[model samples]
Each structure stands twice: as C-alpha cells, then as structure tokens.
Target: MDKRRTLTESALLLLVSLFVMISQGFAAQQVIYLLTAVFLMGIGFLLPKSVNWILILSTMPLCYWWPDIAYYLPPLLRILSMPTKRFEAATFFVYSATLLLLPLSAYQGIIVMLLAISLYLRQNDRAMTTLGQDFLASTDDHWEKQQQLALQNKQLLDSHETQLALQIAEERNRIARDIHDNVGHLLSRALLQIGALETINQEPVLEEPLAQLKQTVDTGMDHIRLSVHDLHADSLSFAEAFQNLLMIEHLCPVEIQGSLFTDLTDKQHNCLSMVIKEALTNTLKHSQATLLTFHFKTLPAFYRLQIRNNGIITNEQYPPKTGIGLQTIQQRIRLINGQVHIAQTDTHFQLTITIPKEPTK
Candidate 1:
C-alpha cells in the first residue's frame, strides 16, 4: 500500500528468482538451505519486505563451497557450487582455518558451513523483527498526533465562531441603540408634524402626499422595530436545537421530517440552526404556497440536512447575495469544513447541507 514498500517488494521478488537460478546445485550440498530461504521470502508470489535481509543472509553458507579454496586442502574442497557474491574468500578462510584444527574432509566442511551461516541468519532475523516493531510504534505515535491536531483545530474554529457571533450580536445591539437615539426621536417629530399638518394644510393634493409620507415613515418605523427584535437562539445543546427545528411548523408550514441517521455533535448545531432559519425565511419570502419540509440524515462521513419547499418559486432572483441570514449560515457550515448546495426546480426548491463527521476534518 505504501509506494516505497511496493517498489522494494518488486525489487526483492526479482532478486529472489535470480538467487534461486544461480544457487541451483552450484554448491551441490548447500541447495536445500538456499531453497528454504527463497520459499520463505516469496511465499505467495508476494514476498514480505521484512524478509529481504534473511534472503541475503541465507546465501552466506554457499561461500565456503566455491572452487577457489580447493588447493589449500584438496580433499575437502569438493563443494564448489554454493552460489553467492559476497565474502567468498572470507568464508573459505574462516571455514578452512577452522577445519585446520581437525581432519579436513567434505562431511566436516558441511558441518562448519552450517554452524557459521545459522548463527548469522538467526541474528539477522531477530534484528529485523525489532526494527519492524520500532516502525510500528512510530506509526502509532504519528496517528495520535494527527488526531490531536484535528481536535485542536476544531476547538480553534469554534472559538472563532463564538467571537464572530458575539460581534454580530453587538452590531445588532448597536443598531438598536442608534434607532433609539436618533431615528426613533426623528420619527416621533415627524409624527407630530403630520398631526399639525392634518389640522392646518387642507389642500387635497398636499393632503394625499402628506398622508403617503406619514405612511412611509410608519413603514420605516416598523422595519426598525423588526430589526431590533433579534431572532437568534443560542443552542444550549443538540436536543434544544433539534426541538427548535421541530417547533418551526408553528411559525411556518415547515414539515420537519427526517431521522437523525448519525449522532449529531455540538459543532453541527450552529450550522443546523442557521439552516433552519434560512429555510423558514425562504418559505415565507419566495415559496408562496404551503408545505415546506426539513429532512436530516446521517452519513458515514457527514451529517446531511435537506430542506425542500413544496411551494412553487415565483421570485426571479430567488438566491440572495451572501449578505443576510444565508451568509451567516454558509459561514458557519464552512467553519466546520462542511458544504452547502441549493437546488430549485418547477415544483421543488431544496437546500442540502453536508457537515463532515470524520476526516479530512
């Protein structure tokens, strides 16, 4: 699965085949040991990389069986075919030197070769296993660090969102303060002027325009009052936010219908709440008919929210600019690495949102 490992495996398999061909009775007596090493490394036409060093070490026994050492002891040099490349001279020297302590014969040379190769192979095997264990431990540590990073990143984003929400709330309160200080008093004065004009200025043309102006001022007053009435609800928990969604049918014809397929988390509530508000607003403003629906479902990697309006869309410019409630909703979802998609057809308008429940988080 890893690129480096794959390449190494490929290379090792080729090397094993070469080793088997070259080792075929080149050393007539050491053939059994060479075959055993090759079989272990390339078992399923898929050699595990962990056995590379073992394969190389298995060839060491064949060195002493080469033809170069026949003159030193003519009687014991019959094993001239153990196929290998490294330390042929060294193996002969060590084996020959050891053989000098006793009678030099073919049978005795075989025993000497076996003893030295077995020791090196066993030591190499143990060392390889220990290195593999160290590699596994390091991998586990890296995985834990990545998880910690993801959690810290999630917390930082939530903190950022809380700060932004506070700022927006402060801006709303400031707007309300401005209305109370300047616009509210100005409208009061305009209402008094309109009252005075009703008594004194009786021209019919002037009267209708003045009445229209008063009506216009009254409309502005109503808008200011609505802006002052903040509609935001800080979700205390997942249950409260979900309950608020269910309660939307009272304010509009919202068919709040769907099973929470996945368990919802606290971070998702911010996005979900904003989505509910947008759906309700869209229903009231663009979708002229009844029966709007909110559906939520769980996915392995994301929590999905689908809002469908059964009402036909009439407003030509249905999708508003990233300015009002929808912008706030979009921003909230993206903070948690979520996505939003809007769709509209002849009879249905849907807003689908997917918030990540897993990684790349």
Candidate 2:
C-alpha cells in the first residue's frame, strides 16, 4: 500500500473511535472515560502487542448501553508485547469510554482493556501485511541490480581475452619475419665469407673483410638473442627497467630527480620503460639542452610518466619537416592502448604518457 494510503486509513479509524466512545457512555462521566480511553489508545499505538490489539478490537462492546463483563476486567495480560500502531490505539480509546459506563466495580476497567487489545491486533495484522510486501519488493530490486553488474563484468572479460589472443598472434608474426629476413640474410653472408677465406689462403690482407664479416655476424647473433628473450618474456619488472633507465644519470650530465618506482605490475613496468627510453632518445636527438627530469606517479589503474627537458625547441631543429622520434613514441603507446603527449615550446619540452592497467596484448 502507498504510505499515504496507510496513513489515511489509520486516521479514519481514529475518528470512528472518538465518536463511538463519546456517545455511548454516561453523559456526565463520559468526558473522564473518553480521556482515559484516549490515553490508553496512545499506549496501544505506542506499544501494540498481539494480544493487546485483539483485546481492543473485541472490547468495543463496552461502548454499548450495557457493557458485559466489563466484569472480568483483569484477566488479559498484554503490556509486555504491544507494538505501536494508530488504528489499534483509537480502538482502545473508545473501549475505555464504554468501559467507564459499566464500572461493575472499581476494577472493571481491566476487562475493557483486555477486549480493546484483542481488536487492535486484528487491525495491526492487516497493516503489517502491507508493510511486508513493500519490503519484499525492495529486496527483489537489489538482487536484480547485482545480477546486471555480474553480466557486464563477464562481457568485459570476454572482450579482453579476445584482444590478448589477437595481439600475441601479431607479435609472433613480427618476430618470425624479422628473424627470417635480417638474421637469415646476415648468417648467409657470413657463410660466403668463410668459403672465400678457405679457398683463398693468399695474403693476410684478404682476411680484413672477413673479420668485418665476423663482426657483423656477432652483432646479428646478439640482436637475435635479445629478440628471442623479449618475445618469450613479454614483461619486465619495475626494478629491472627503472634501474636500466637510471644508468643515464651517472653517464650523462643530466640530473635526474624525484622518487624511483616503488612497485608496478609487469606490463606497467614494461610500458613505462619503453616510454622513458623513447623520451630520452628524443631529447638527445632533437634538443641540445643538458638537464632532464623524470617524475612518475602510481595511480589506481594506470601510471603517469612525465619527462621535462630544459632545452628550447629551436625552429631549425624542431623537426617540423619530419618528427620521426615523435611518431615512434606515438606508435609504441598506441600498440598498448596508452596515450602519449608531446609539448614543445620556447622554454621546455614535456612528454607525458599515461598507460592503462590492461594494455592491448
């Protein structure tokens, strides 16, 4: 039931109780009885009991011309359990007035109280039923909201899993193509040099180009080894990457400041490491300024990387014709679904990168 409806219904019952109690009692004693009943009604509403409502409802007989067993007044015992409700309260009021008229003895008011309580119980039970239905409806709505959240979470997980699989495939293809082309061709060239060296044992001068060939072979081998390790690992922890980045502080005149990384997930560590490397390379290649500062902060789901260089972006060297460094950083960030921002002005150049918690494969 609407809250308004419940209120209105209780009001009507109160009005009925007042009128009946006033008219049926002794004319002279009516006011006293009515007042007493009103006070008792307050108690019933304030503290209704199962037995009390029942008594109040049944005791309406006391408002009649001859109140019966307005006699056995003291038997009902209900003060202990009454829970307050309005209708039952009014019923007790009228019952009290009617009981005053009976006054079988000084103690007759007790019987009327008992009967008043009984009737109040019946009315209270109806109100409680309506209240129970409202409670159940609210519970149902709460359960439905929880179910919707669970479904949305499931969909998001499924999408992430699909993207991860696609990215792994792409990485695999890239590694395959690089190894087959660069490493394969370099090794093949090295083999030809070995054949030439074996057949032509002429002069020591012929061996110079073969030594260069051997150096190329070693470099190719090193590149292949690093590539294979990276392909398998897919991640670098915070300590390793941050330590590698810090190596610059000792070697260059640049003064690096601010807190080092405390902790980061494997993927976050990798993304930040790449961004730092790219930013430092750009600073050296583009700007001739000396000082560099890196500030990193850990957020709930991502990391914020800021690199500031005190070098001014000169008009001639700002690379407006071609920003290859900027393009490379942008591509790397995009691969992981992260964002990179480059701001170069007369006074300073800032590179800020935000990498999300879950990167694209």
Candidate 3:
C-alpha cells in the first residue's frame, strides 16, 4: 500500500463529500458531515500510518448520519481498515461493514462495485511485482553459474594443451637420440671403411669414382647431423639459444636490449632461434658491420624482434641480392602468420619482425 496514494484518495473523498453536502436537501447536518470528512482527510494525510485507528472511529459517523456521498465512505473505510502487510480476518469484518452500509442505488452501487474491482487489481499488481523480483534473482544466479562453467572449461583446455606439448617434446627428443646413436654410428663406420679402402692401390679411373662416392656420402652424413640437431632444438631455452648465437665469433660487437617472455610454444621458440641465427650469420658473412644491435619487446597484442647492423658500408648502388638465409627467415615468419620488414640504407641494414601474441586461426 502506497502512503501518498492513500493520502490522495482520502483528499479526493473529502472533495466528493463537499460536493455531496452541496447537493443534499438537509442543511443542518451538512456542515457536520463536511467537517468529519475534512478531519478524516487531514488524519489520512498527516498520520497515514495511523489511518487504521481513525477508521474505527470514522465508521460511527457514516452509519449514524449517512452523508449524501456516503457511497465513497465504504471503499475508503475498507481501504484503511484492511491489513497492509497481508490479508487477515479483519478484512472480512470490513467487507461486512461495506456490504451492510453501502448506499442502495443503481448509480452508487455501480460506483462501489468499481472501487472494489480497482482494489482487487492493485492487489494482483503487487503479487506480480514480487514474482518479477524473484525471477530476476534466479536469472542472476544462472548467469553466475554459466560464467563459472566457462572458466572451468578454459582451465581444462589449457591443461590438456600443456600435456600435449610435453608429450611432443619427449617424442622429438627420443627421435633425435635414435638418429644420433644408430644412424650416426653407421655413418662413422662407413667413413672408416672408405678411408681404409683409399689406402689400397687402385686404378686411376676407380680412384676418381671412389673419391666422388666418399664426398657424396660425407655430404649426406652432414645433412643427417644437421637434421638431428634441429629435432632437439626445442629443448633449448630461448635466452640460452640467443646467447649462444651471440657468443659465436664475429667481427663486430653485438648489443642486446629487452628479452622475450617464456609463454611461447616450442614451435615459436624454434622459429625465433632460427631467425636470430640466420640474421647473425648474414651480419658476420656479408656485412662489414662494426656494431650489431638486437632489440626484443613484447606488447599487449604482439611481440617484436628487430636486428640492425651498421656494417654494410656500401650504399645501394644496385639491388641487394636476397639470399637463402633471408628467404628462410621470411618463410619461418610466414608460418606463424607474422610480418617481416627489411630496410637497407647507405650505412646500416635492419630486419624487423612482428608476431601477434595470439594468432588468429
């Protein structure tokens, strides 16, 4: 029950009573009826919380000296007397009073019936409001549960991915070991046999073919050794690998800035290692660079690698040839959907690579 609304209704009832007093044929009791109605309105507005007490006293006047607008009395009285918290036995007593005293006329009867209907509808409205609040509370609980499930699912997926990566690394290490222990030993024996046969006297024609065969076999063995090293490359930490590349003998001084975080996958680590190795090789072999600089940085959405050298003294008099090392760097970057840019000026050469931290599938 709204206090303001109840007060407004009480005030309106007083106004109706004033209109009724003016229409009534009797003059002696009109002033008394008007005064009673005004007094009740004032009580309703000023002490809305105590309106029920006023209601008990109010009914005496309505039954004793029925006002011209007595039709308004029963509804107003019923509203005030009814329990605000919940329905109670007191409601039936108010209902009985309303039925017994309500003005018996088609017009007044119809008005009384409408007032009852209005009260009934307002009760229904309050019930619906309570239900709506409960529904919203239930919806909030459901949304929280969904969020918890999503977080749990993500954790499970990350754990699975970590296990898969460990298994792959183990498998790669096993393969590298097998290749080194078995294939490497076999190649060494073949080389020893070839050397022993070389010392034996042979025709000049046979000697030439045997030397060519030995060269081919040595080249194949070198390729196999390189493959085995690559297979085990994933075991090396990024920092260790980068430092090893820097420690290699070079004509120029190498400077490093920033560092990479350890949240990268094995494939990313391997690719980055190869890029640094190839870039440094180019600097040592081709650039007469006196100073080499390597810069690494991680951003919110991307990781950047930059390598620059001030060794290329030659200005771009003509196009610089793109070598296999540079080509390999580009291919590795492409595999991760990264971008690589190269810049060469009269005194310096720079390679910049940027890879998104989370690559889109």
Candidate 4:
C-alpha cells in the first residue's frame, strides 16, 4: 500500500473509532482499546513487510472478541492490503474461526463478515493502484535511459566516421605532396634532358625521332601535374574549408547551425564552398547586416543550405542589375542538378540551396 493512502485510511478509521467510543459513553477501557488499535496500525504501516502478518494477527482477535470494539476492525484489517502470501492459509483459518465464534446474532455476524469483505476489497484496490503507479514510473525511467543510450551510440559512430575521413584526406594530401616533389621533379628533369638532346642532334633523320621523344616526355610531365592537382583538390575537407572561409573579418556576428553528416562528393563540396564564400562576401560588401546565419540540413534525398541575414538592401547596386553573382551561383548549382532560391524582404535576405543526391537530367 502507498504510504499516503495507508496513512489517510488509518486516520479516518481512528476518527470513526473515537466517534463510536464517544457515542457509547466513553469508558476508560474502551479508550485504551482505541489507542492500542491506533498504535498497532501505525506500527503495521511502518514495519517491514516480512513481519506485518504478526501485527495483523495480533490486532484482529482484539478487535473481534472485544465487545463494542468492532469499530476498530476495519483499520486492523487494513494490514491485509499488503501481500502476505506466505501466511495466506494461516490467515484464512484465523478469519474462519473468528467469524464462527462470534458473540453476535446471525444477522450481526453476517453484517460483520460483509464489512470485512468490503474493506479487504477496497484496500486491495488501493494496493493495485499503488503497484500500477510504481510500474509506470519504472517503465518511464527505462525508456528515457534507452533513448539516451541510443543518442550516445549515434554520436560515437559519427565521431568515428569523421575521424576516419580526416585520416583518409590526410593520407591523400601526403601522397599528392610526395608525387609533386619526387615524381614531378623526375618527369621535369626527363623532359629537360630530351630537349637538350634535341638541340645537339644535327642529323635530319634523327631529328623527327628526337622530337617525338621530347613530345612523349612533355606529355608524361603534363599527366603527372594533372594527377597531382586532382589529388590535392579531391582531398580538401569541406568542414575545414568552411572554417577557413569564415575566419575573415566580418561586420556582423555570424551564427552557423546544423551539420551534414552524409559524405559529399568533391564537386559538391567545391560548389557549396564557393557559393557560401560568395554569399558571405556579398553580405559584407553590400548589406548593412547585424546578424548572419548559415544553416545546413540533410534530407532523405537532398542536402539543404541556407544563408540568411537580418539586413536590408538599400543601394541600387546591392543586387546588381545584371545579377552576375546570382547567375554564377545558379550555374554552379545547375551543374549538379541542384536548386537555388533567393529571397529578399524588408527585414531579411535569404539564400536557399538544395542539392539532390541523384542528378535529375
């Protein structure tokens, strides 16, 4: 039984017992009996569950056999609300004997039995209610813990992926540097040697072959340079690039929110980086902005970028008549089959970009 409900029931029973004693013309012994019943109830509610049956059995006979003290029986029986499974058979025998040996008439005995049954049912209901509340509280706690654990696991997985990507980028940069320093220098030296040999050869027949050799070395050097450039460009980290771009002095406070956990292709990264740089430059140069916001989101099939500022375009040249910057942004997005939306209101200017995962046409 819940402590508060047990206390409430016990207090109400005490009041009833006192009323009965007072109406019957208070006797010293009857007052003593009422006090003893209240004491036993307090102890029963406070004591451990294992020994509660002892208190229940002790108080029952006192209330049952004593004349005019039956008013205290309900409170004494409240102990039955607790689970006393081990002493179930013993309590059953005790109740049966007490009812059979009652000193009252048959009708009074029937009424008393009915009263006892009703009190047991009511207390049992209270017990069930208390049990249900506890179960709900425990279940809620379990669910909250499960949600927290799932969030932590996702964060851990994302961190691991980010670190792995960084490591791969670093390795690519190292390889690019090595190729530029060693293989590129060797190719350049080979081309120079072929040129020198061509200059010394005077025979007309050998001139054509030497020229072909020089062309082959030149082609090899060009291939190496292109390979090195591609490696360096592909290895650039979008996050680092964004941070570096934002490091420039700004007239307004910039708030960057949200992140894209999905991996982006090199072309997508370059496009976004360039678009953001242009937007920031325009905002700083043209608009009298107090706050700028950069927001990113990843959808099921697209990546979204939003650059918004709380600034008004007052100058006629703010969004130039030709709209060259906007056109360039559109062209870049079109290459990736993405969408760009530019909105200007009295209070704000917003640029929205949505890049689809798969090309449309």
Top lDDT prediction, candidate number? 4
Off by over 4 Å in 4: 17-28, 60-65, 79-82, 85-100, 104-118, 121-130, 133-141, 144-152, 155-167, 170-361
| TM-score of predicted structure 1 | 0.38
Ranking by TM-score: 3, 4, 1, 2
How many residue pairs of model 2 clash at the backbone?
28
The per-residue C-alpha lDDT of model 2 at residue 247 equals: 72
* Cα lDDT listed for each candidate: 0.55, 0.58, 0.65, 0.70
| lDDT string, candidate 3, 1-361, tens digits | 4555555655554455455445535677767766665565455445544446556556556644573535455335434534353542344345445545655444454445544543554465456656888888999999999988985676556445544654576578679878989998998888888888887847776787778878988998999888888887555678877777788774489888888646665567766776788788777877688899888898888889899999773434323445545666776677667889989888888999998786421
State which candidate, 1 or 4, has the greater lDDT.
4
Task: Give the TM-score comparing model 2 with the true structure, all chains together.
Answer: 0.38
Where does candidate 3 have its weakest 10-residue lDDT segment?
Answer: 313-322
lDDT, candidate 1, at 234: 31
lDDT of 2 by residue, 94-125 (tens): 64666666645544444554546445544565
Higher-lDDT candidate among 2 and 3? 3
Q: Which parts of model 1 have CA positions greater than 4 angstroms off?
A: 1-110, 200-209, 230-361
What would the per-residue lDDT of candidate 1 be over residues 135-224, giving only the tens digit for each residue?
A: 999999999999889866766675576558746744555566677669878987898899789789968879888889899988987876
**Model 3: CA > 4 A from native:** 1-119, 233-361
State the lDDT at 270 in candidate 1: 50
